[model samples]
Target: TIPACNANYLPEGISEHCPIKVTFVEEGLNTNKLFQFCNVWAKHPLFIDKVQAAWVKLLMVLLKKELKVLNTQFFRNVVAEANDDRMALYLAQNKLQADPMNMTLQRRREGEILEVQKYIIYGRDVLTT
Candidate 1:
């Protein structure tokens, strides 16, 4: 059976002093039996919502982790995969341009070069009036 959930969490932007509690519970202990039982619940409508909610929660956690790793090449690959080369380049240029001022990330030499290259590429070099 799919586990039922009850939530009484307060709405966002209401209180700054209130503490929140989160809990996860698994009812049965038999691993093989539980797998079979969960399989049946997968086709149920109520269980589908629960499963999707859990998946969304999992994705949120994964996204948070990905955002934390700024210098990872895998993240750069993922960003490139999500956008075309031109768009990705534009985004990288914009980020690199602003990175020196953002307190969250320490500026790098490559970032400064990107900023200068973007300026030279797009700045007032030609006339089109």
Candidate 2:
């Protein structure tokens, strides 16, 4: 016999060593179950409306989760690129100071350094537009 379930709980098993009890499945790949609505419930006028409301709520929750993942990735990539550029310029400047005549460090023009700084300081705000 199937036990009662709510929004976040599902009955999994019962203890066999002593008094029989129901253990709910809190997490696992196959823990989520399907919605089972009896056809007889259609006789109620509010049944359809209730189902629609439930489905809409579920869709909203799923959409929010997806948006969170996308936002996290966007921030991660944007910030990582910005940090990389800043680190590159800083490292080159440090090396140039150590070896004042290094040709590679001298190749990094002042304009290029300014461009990198501008991108990190201002271009990162491009997401607002």
Q: Per-residue lDDT of 1-129 in model 1, one digit per residue for the tens?
A: 657555545311111233345455656675564434547777777997887899999999999777648624544543333234334344544564466566433344344334434433665322111
Model 1 residue 1 CA deviation (Å) reads: 34
lDDT of each prediction vs. the true structure?
A: 0.48, 0.58
What residue pairs are clashing in model 1? none
Off by over 4 Å in 2: 1-76, 109-115, 118-129
lDDT of 2: 0.58
Q: Alpha carbon lDDT of residue 62, candidate 1?
A: 94
TM-score of each: 0.26, 0.33
Give one digit per residue, the lDDT tens place, for model 2 in 1-129.
565544432211111122234565545466668999789899899998999999999999999788768856775655455556555655666566678687866676343466455654674532211
Clashing pairs in 2: none
